[model samples]
Target: MDHRFEIFLACAPGLEAALASEAKGMGFGPLRPMAGGIAFDGTWRDVWRANLVLRGPARVLARIGGFPAVHLAQLDKRARRFAWGDVLRADQPVRVEATSLRSRIYHEGAIRGRIERAITEELGSPVADDGVRLLVRIEENLVSFSIDTSGGPLHRRGFKQAVGKAPMRETLAALFLRECGYRGTEPVLDPMCGSGTFVIEAAEIACGLAPGRARKFDFERLSGFDPQAWAQMKADAAPHPCDLRFYGSDRDAGAVRMATANAERAGVDHLARFECRSATAIERPDGPAGLVMINPPYGERIGKPGPLYGLHRDVGAALMERFRGWRVGVITTEAGLARATGLPFLPAGRPVAHGSLRVRLYQTGPL
Candidate 1:
């Protein structure tokens, strides 16, 4: 069994450096930040720990091996000869997906069929729609293989069951927090806290809690996996107590209730609190100034940014008036909408693809 593996952490396109920054902080690399993700070389244990602890990646992939295959016959012969039993179970069904990029083998369907046949005939594994996904990429006659080790997605975190409109994904929230210089030391407040993603993530970081502690991963089904070892690894994640409290405020009472419930499910209810209040009605908490991060509605979700100018103005006014000394981060799709806040937002990060629309993080220095 080759224990050495190349780990890839997939995040939003514009968030490569932010995720790399986190990977660096956690000592996960000598890191390499790529287009849509970052990769590091480590043991399988590092793969498990990355799955458990890293908060900014949508999913984790383990690159197994590759070979130069200029044709479908070559691909089939090599994929079958390539090690399968070392990682994949013979009895378990698997899904084969392939992409051909500037390669002699241009037919992706044929590539998938060949690899699928190889797995079934040689490895005795059936190809099924809902099985573990094996990604095959053939670029310029070189084929590479990677397993989707993190499962459905790391952002699921298995805690946040409640989500409001245009809710931010947990991975994006974590990267945006890092972009705003949040390191779990101070408090975080989201006036437009959609389902409390930021608040719960911040609280977990503060309390030294693993983001994946409450979730199950797809890697558990892989061959050569040691349940006892993984259990012991999870058991070692003892959370350290933190006194700082994460706060969230929303105008809707239902949103407040949802946020509170999410925090409770995340086991950080003791460190997080949600209140029913509008941005203009929010007052500064009686503690040291921290970070105020908000992902307000940016027309892509609810409506146009034309009607949102006043809302942005009010939020900016509220921060400038009462919440002096706190830094701020505003995420939105429209540059005009972000500027409408009237706060002194500095240069923003590159636009991140939230969904069909690209969003940017507008930040400001301490007020």
Candidate 2:
């Protein structure tokens, strides 16, 4: 049964427009953009497709059901009345979490206990740590539930076993690429590619490879999951030929090796090339003009030493001198470090949450 429900595609702060565009490109919409995500209508099959194809969203949550509850008694009664067999199984464990805001049931612990008892009593199942997660939210005296269908964060992508310090996530890389107006038609170069995230993502896009193709998900453990249909979906995602090759250059030879190995693991090594060279030595590639994207250290992930400014300046000088007609994107935590590039960046975007520090995407038009 293709029962329709709300699916929220959550993303990093300040990049909802880009994620919406990606969904629209994939033929999903009239979407509503919220504070941290986009909400749309879909069924289990749509959920599966979303988990399989989309690259920008960090998590895919299915809003299943909810009701108004002014007190714990009402919450317990309504929770027990809901049929858990339709969604969860009785043989396995299920994890329940809750949050509350502007509601009478403000205590999260009490809310969790009531819901847990209701589920255990109704479904005859135990609540364990590693069980299927059910998020219960009490907002304004109403309780709602959502299933984290993706299990782990979507950025894992089941590849890139090796990484350097302060590495960029695959989901963020894909969204940043979209925010920079990239559609995978031309080449892409990452001068500071730590593990070749941008280059590999670009290559996969150009070849039409699904990001979640190689990964497993939590939805498979739920009831009514059709293994045969999911297999067919994965089998149908055929990769197209991409003549354009993506490039990544790093001063660390170890980073170069790690990137090459990661590309191979991601099945895009043939279309991606990694070079162990300084950023100042990186020149524009042959053929069509494309993008120059980099995430340089600005004391956020590592120390912001004095030479960091010189490194940005030298990289900026190299791109300015060698790469004419190419656009650029630099992600940094501080505006001063971005200014050190001296590139004509467009107005800065809102600060994005990158671990402890928030960073912004500094983009430029064709130079």
Candidate 3:
């Protein structure tokens, strides 16, 4: 058998284009950008590589099989005949989740129960609510089945035990770096580095380190897994020596400690430096100009927005006065706060759904 499968790279709603660009640069083939993700055709090896290398996708899913089922009876019958043994193992417990849209089989709970029973009865596997997830989507009378190849969200990265109040996810930080035209050749600075996400990600990218190197994936437990191939793939990761250094700073002492420990855990502590300093106190280091990215508190869940205006203004002043040739990327939830900075910002991107509030990335040319 060819063992080729259709794969979906899930990302934040507004970041599909950035993820597609990164995927294409990494050599994933036959790709199409969708509403919330990117779709592509690849084999098992490709699946493993994607989970190992992709930095922007929240998760990687493999479309296993599908069929047209208008009602419960047809769904049960078709699901029973599907090749369950091809992907799932009899010893591993599984979880089935279903969503219906514009289909006669509209009850999500009933659809999940039928698929769960079918897999258990046919494949002799146990069903658990928290086990590996198998997603079923019914749309316009067509049912599609996919397996969550990535166990947890890729942002976990198996590092950073401690986090700040509104820490940015590693995947989003990587995409933001790319959006700011960062190609891993120059240094990066994060004035409000919550848990050091941006700084660590920049160091990893510059060193050519794989994001999933320290983590495990759900695909390792599948029946089609090849240990020898996986070992070879992991061994092929080539980490290069980087001359550029990354920096992060925060006023909270505990946050600075967390960032330092996280950088140490990520094995990039030598290249990344963290400090406890207010944003306005940040000074440009002695080097060529690079990118300065910050995800400051947007007052959505924290303090009031009035005081943040001055904070943003002070940050803008520090950047404009000290770092004259560097570009800036600011992620905030309000346009007024960005405008308060008084920095000459270019046009903002679409609002991205981050938690309950929508956020946007405002960029600036060299100051």
Task: Assess every candidate by TM-score.
Answer: 0.98, 0.98, 0.98
Clashes in predicted model 2:
0
Where model 3 places Cα greater than 4 Å from the true spot, the runs are: none
| Backbone clash numbers for all candidates listed | 0, 0, 0
> Model 3: which ten-residue window has the lowest total lDDT?
1-10
Q: Against the hidden true structure, what lDDT does model 3 obtain?
A: 0.92
lDDT by residue (50-89, candidate 2, tens digit) is 9999999999998989999999989999999987888887
Query: Scored by CA lDDT, what does every candidate get?
Result: 0.89, 0.91, 0.92
Least well predicted 10-residue stretch by lDDT in candidate 1: 1-10
Task: Sort the candidates on lDDT, descending order.
Answer: 3, 2, 1
